[model samples]
Target: MFAPMDSTEIFWVATICVLLAVELATLGLTTIWFVGGALIALAAYECGAGMPLQLILFTCV
Candidate 1:
């Protein structure tokens, strides 16, 4: 069985995946920043940051 993951974690992971797919399909590199942002948000979530903090990290990173 897969390891249990929080819904927020799944959301960030899915965001990263979709952004990556879009970046690959277009190769325009625009979504790369979003991928980085999602990664930061994921890390923040793993560190138990609140949604507001996670969002700030996502936007600032």
Candidate 2:
């Protein structure tokens, strides 16, 4: 049996993708910073950080 990714992981990844897409489409710096934060949170999620920790890192980044 293959298990799917958790909801949190899915959301974070989706957020990262969407942010990158929007940033690229606009070629703007606004969302780039957010993309950095989202990437950090996504990495943290992959490293097994909890939601609260992810949110904190996202905000700090």
Write down the TM-score for model 1.
0.91
For model 1, the stretches where C-alpha displacement exceeds 4 angstroms are 1-3
Number of backbone collisions per candidate: 0, 0
Q: What tens digits encode model 1's per-residue C-alpha lDDT throughout 1-61?
A: 9879978999999999999999999999899999999999999898889999999988887
Candidate 2 accuracy as lDDT: 0.90
Per-residue lDDT of 1-61 in model 2, one digit per residue for the tens? 9679889888988998999899989996889888899889989988999899999999898
Clashing pairs in 1: none
